[model samples]
Target: MNVHIEVRRVNEAGEERTRTASIRDVARAADVSYQTVSRVLNDHPSIRPATKQRVLDAMEELRYRPNQAARALVTSRSSTLGVILGSRGEYGPTSSLAAFEDSAREHGYWVNSAYLRDTQPETIRAAVEHLRRQSVEGIVVHAPQVRVFDILAELDVDIPYLGLNTAERGIVELAEDQMRGGKMATEHLIELGHVEIVHVAGPQDWIEAESRMRGYLHALSDADLPTRAPILGDWTADFGYRAALELSHRLDFTAVFAANDAMAVGLMHGFRDVGIDVPRRVSIVGFDDIPLAAHSWPPLTTVHQQFAGLGRRAVTELLRLINADDAPPLLASVEPSLVVRASTARAFGHQ
Candidate 1:
């Protein structure tokens, strides 16, 4: 199926001929039809793995490069996706975003991102409009703040959209089960026989923070344990350290569950400075299981979220919506697991 065309050039009374590789050349190399090559380029899910690999190998052998402009004109598809971010610097969101981009590229798509400076309705609408202007086929919203969803609901977004961190059920969204993670962390502490456990939670407005706090309370309530009001934090080590100082004077709680690893590590440092040995006099658990968690002084006992899995699933679902293909089953809410480490132990004196 390879198409051959000759180009003639003359230099110093000498004639030369050459040819450039085309999609048909790739098809010939793979022993596939040109239409099969087109399907491979579009990452059609119906294509078998062996066929896809063969196409990819053929494209590489032929040095075939897809001309995005030409493909867009022929198919009327932009082959691009849009992502809107309300929280940019956090560990969990950033980790998920990296995985999402990697999955998109593997599926033969490019990503365009817009970072939100504020959660204002107008700002959210403007970001969506900007992405639409570039003809993105789908959009992924990574803003976990509660108000951001409210603002998004007010906008007249026409394209397919997926939410990475929203709590709304029955929506086209993929997210780690934050509430389950929180419950797992708290239940770990409870299993260690720590009844008076304090929770240092993230900002009140963040959907993740609220969901986690709800989990913590749910665990304590289910166990018939008295629940103390949670300490709201700004999801920072500095805030965790400050909270530790304030909690040090209150001898009421023997354990603390932090919303994320950064705060947990900082809280550990603060407790050490105050002479409260973790797992000895006080136990600590955190969420997200950031890379540093396992190396902290006592090694943090935390909940591990499937950030990468959720990211990949988000792309698959969004693409399904874009293609209007509902034949494939979608993954459910990602589950979280508890990683027990040195930071937690049986109740004091029971050890």
Candidate 2:
């Protein structure tokens, strides 16, 4: 009679150890090929159910675990996406980041985030480089500053990239219809019989602010109303306060269209401090109906940009680009709606 016994090896510590098992080991135990084990490990749909079960059972019996790092190297895909966002404490950026996170999670991708307070070209390049070093499959740039566009233009990254709240520049761009949003706010105020309107604009460096200012101008021109240079603000309540103080000296306009709801709320407070009543004296309208817009003394009538949807779409587009070999870059826009609230009413005497 002939008999065979499996022999294990012992190290200097005198502990017996079995050789580390691989997909080949599992396949041999399961009476399958290495390729079949690989397909099962990757959850390929074409694998037969029974075969997959046998491979899984073999892996269990051999106590085998896949080396994820080696697998990523072989596939050249890290299954991760990078997002660069502004550090500003504002509704637009904050809401967008949240939406991107939710969307990426649903798509089975992990998000790595980087925040910048000021969008300098060098800073953006550094962020992109950092994400690339991590081998993220793609990047989602949430910087709305035009400077970001300039910076991105200089980089020669082979990996796919997407922009959120910015226009397309040879890459996927997703944003709300800012021009429409601005027009909606202005037209609503105009319909309410406010002929003289002032726009308290945000920082000109941001594409959103610039687009909104254009829309405001377009609405005024279409209505044949006179246009004035926008009073620049920094998308901050404090800036709106100072702007309102400056405007109070002139007191020439019957209505104010602030770039965003924060400025609108601030303008209302500033007006109140100067003995001016909202809607009663000067009707106010704002863009980006942030949460605070509704909680104002009199709820704010403003344009609601679907920030969450924009964020979700940005991630979707980024993923699409990442998975495709020759996917055309796209520019997607989410529609914004006007929300009528107490902050606006027909010009005092027009009603």
Candidate 3:
């Protein structure tokens, strides 16, 4: 008997041409029944083990390949989730996405990623719409900008969603305690007998930056030290460099707490250019104990945020949201810890 294979072809007008093939053609080749072949192809679990093997063998003999799109049409599940991120080059966002992808794969889901340079409301709306079009079951918004939350609040999508690293109001959120991180860094400096401490802060618009700034003030107030206005930065090495240059000219403070390790590294270089000795003339502390922090001159004393763990937890929460598994939406806040290193020392007089 001739075994014919069905194929789809596009006509000159771009319409599909469908053709049919017979199950008898497949079953005869492997000496199995058409019923057994149907059961094996449809993944019916009731078939006996020996019979199932014969049906599979028949399919192999006929070189049968199942149509995934047809299967999806019946199930109504695309088995995909969407992740929207801000700034792919940043350490935290990039690491979170990688972790989420791995976790999604483990749960038998595919992740569609979209990275944005800025988190404007319109841009976020567009991104969310794009993901919805792809039939994603849920969404993980990784943009930390406060405006993204506003955009999310206005969205009409029926799918469940979660935000990582953004502030919490009513929605489910997963973030590090930035205020605690700031307080930890500042209090450490104060404990070292550095009363005149300055903060080099990240952009004011970002919730993380604002929280850290508040923590710094809280620490200073508790210690009875005067809190100076913080110098603003864009969380970049360049911004840190420029801020350091401006601060070095006057040299009013004995200690500095930069919002992140990259800025701290930049400040160190800036101070070196001005012929100032670190931990002697001025001690410095930084947040986010990134890899480069350890290699910096005199090594950086910094705050460690468990970025990878944050990523893992965020994805886990997102998966729960996707499954409609009767789990409560989680609001997780990770605490920051201080990592003491060589960049800080006793006050100039005590040493």
Candidate 4:
């Protein structure tokens, strides 16, 4: 059947008007039926290459764009992936998202993303529902909050879903070892002859924050070092600066380990403002080795997570779930590395 479509165009006067360029119009232009055009769009195996070329050429000539919804209805495949994020411009989540999109595109899939405005169950449900309506083949969740998963578990999510920062038993979680990274950061300071180490942590509810804090505590306990209370931060450089101002008045700790590079860099600024030299007075270390970590003043000693690798891995695993492939054993966690730099040094007396 020939289906006619009216496509709009503009004249030299820029007045609104109507133009028609239907599948039938494409068929006439290419000397084929509208059915052939539909088949071409769906990549039906039966269409000859030469005939497919004519339809494609006709589409190009007529500037006809196929409706994705219509195509999905015919093929029962949307070739789309959904990503749900619960970050406010944090480097790790943001970096991972970019890599995931690139990898999805490489696999000939389109990506749709939704950011959580809040962690309320209703918000998470809406985000999932919005993506599901698009007929996404799978969903990759990067929301790091503990409650996000709790809420997700409650939702009747029928599609294949993968989590990037969870270790829940039922959820397919893929993540770098945040605890190890935190331990690595703290241990580096301990190895530098620093005993009075303080932790600058992210929000209390975040999974990454909790994991890294555990690592810090574990390192301290292993060395039999006295533990002071960790200062909770909001994963912002500004918060680090403020925390620095508060800590500068004290003479207890000689080193600080931050949950993220942004806070680490801010801590450096705050210390500088208070006439405290980084590493020389208070050694600092951070996580996520963002691009600016090495470029920060005195350079930051931090943990390097393979965020991009994790993102690519997530896409691959999600696809496997979507395809119902014979799944292989999953990696326990992605390992993180420590990057030693000028920001950390031997504790005051040792130096």
Candidate 5:
């Protein structure tokens, strides 16, 4: 017996239309049992190569797509992951989220994010519960605040979660080596004969800020240089501008290490306004070699963080945990490199 059915449905225009191809249609077109089609869809090993090829050809001809949601329902795998994201508008987090979703989709999974408007304990709990109810297999925590980590640790949520750009204490974390970047930035200035270096640091509570400040201090300690009070900032260009104004009154330093590029550029602008000639009077270096860093009035010297690579690895690690697979051999962390530019120069009056 031979039977091939063309599925038909009525459209909003009151006209008959051919619906999208389904697995049953593939089975009918391939002249195979529906169960055989299911086996092919799941890559069952028992299916002969000839039969597999035939099924595949039929599927390609019919433009058939298996319903991921339906497959998920049957296999108890939602094929979806969740992310708890903070600092959504920042360059690094924004770039990382896009790259993370791209990598997840390439692996046949979907990503959902719950942006934290407030990092309060109760608010964090509610966000966690919302994602939990969505049946996401795993979660990536992109909240960079130390307090957020404490909040997440207190929650009893059972889902496997990975923290991005976080510390390595009792948590699986992925990030470019920020301390290395910080040290590299400071060392660049030190090598240029700038002994009196100041650091424009981010908020103390941020993991990156803490690590960068530590690295800056370490570099000074190794050089037998005394540490000065760091100008704490909010990671904003405006803050950098203000810090530069403050530093103008105390011309004790020959160089400034701004924690990130945004602040560094603002510091340059602020110094110009205050008649402090950069490089000649004060050399500047920054972390996170953002795109605009290269195009600034004087191209910036900074450390480049691999934001995309970190995001990709975060998804990979989270998936392994979700699948209950043994952890892969630890790979080398992504190393940031120093990018020298006109923003840095040899110390003024140095030969």
Candidate 6:
């Protein structure tokens, strides 16, 4: 049923006209039953694809848009997914969010994201409670901190949830092969003949950081190179700068591999300030080739993680569990690429 309002006015000088496009109007234009139009709008799986396409084409020709409140009342599902993320400002999370939203819309669902202002247990609990109130059908947890898992375990909510990057054995989780990525970064430096390569790695709690560190160690072990313990960092440029200055005192390694591009950029800045030219004196490499990495002062040589593909994969896996579909075949690990740039060069005496 559609509502119509009559607007009466004088003729000629001031006249009123009726204007509306309703579901019934769309059905009449499409020459289909009103129930068929409703089925198309609701994305009923039973409808034949040809019929659905025809209904969609007709709706477009008639300019049909459904009323949200009315539709939700009929469907009994929110058509919304909750996204719980650590931060919205970071390059990785934001990139993942874009892919997640795009994929959700393609599947006829909307997103409700919560960028945690605080990561405390109480704060995280509150955020989940908030999403529950919104009646979100599922959740996509983009929160990468180790503490996040702990909190979620405590809540143990029954709603379907997905993680962007974490090792949760049976659940849906997606992570760029951080270990392989780490090894690639380290191996690239070794190929450049940097014998003494130190690493400025992200904090120990992060799953990626730990995997990357393991890779670094594995590569060094394979090459019979010295295993110099990495200096832990906070995944920030400021920390990178400070770590570089601290390195000036020890100054044993001819190369450095920071865990992320931002830190690598900061390390370059720090090296420049102290007159230690990159590649000439100290070669450097980083990970997660952020948008600005290619344009950095020395053009950071880093590992490129396919975040867009990862996001899409996460959605696929999550939706599989959400819809109770058969599990997908085992897929190969996401390969991270080593992007060589001007930041690394052959060892001083290797020429």
**Candidate 4 per-residue lDDT over residues 169-215, each given as its tens digit:** 22333333888789999999999999999999999888889989999
**What is the per-residue lDDT of model 3 for residues 126-157, given as tens digits with 9 covering 90 to 100?**
88888877778788877657887777787765
Model 6 CA deviation exceeding 4 Å by range: 1-37, 43-76, 169-173, 329-333
lDDT minimum window of 10 residues, candidate 5 = 167-176
Q: How well is each residue in 69-141 modelled by candidate 5, as lDDT tens digits?
A: 6876777788899999877788999988998899999998888889889789998998889887777889999
| lDDT leader | 4
Candidates' C-alpha lDDT:
0.85, 0.81, 0.78, 0.87, 0.85, 0.80
For residues 1-351, what per-residue lDDT tens digits would candidate 2 score against the true structure?
012223357989999977778788787888889999988977899999999998888887777888766777877877678988765577888887788888888987778877776777777778888887777888877776877867787777677887766667422223438877888899999999998999999887887888889889999999999999998888888888777788888888889999998889889989888988888878898998898899996899999987888878777677777778465645455688899999888887787
- Clash pairs detected, candidate 5: none
Question: With candidate 1 superimposed using the best TM-score fit, by how many Å does residue 189's alpha carbon deviate from the native?
Answer: 0.9
The positional error of residue 105 in candidate 6, measured at the CA in angstroms, is: 1.5
Residue by residue across 28-95, what tens digits does model 6's lDDT show? 76678889999988778888998787778776665667876577678867777888888667787788
Best by TM-score: 4
TM-score of candidate 5 on Cα atoms, chains taken together: 0.86
What is the C-alpha lDDT profile of model 1 across 228-277, one tens digit per residue?
98999988999988888888998778899999998999899999999998
When 2 and 4 are scored with lDDT, the better candidate is: 4
Sort the predicted structures by lDDT, highest score first. Answer: 4, 5, 1, 2, 6, 3
Model 2 has how many clashing residue pairs? 0
- Model 3: C-alpha RMSD to truth? 4.7
Error of 6 at 213 (Å): 1.7
Candidate 1 residues lying further than 4 Å off, grouped into runs, are 1-74, 169-176, 328-333
Cα distance off (Å), candidate 5, residue 119: 0.9
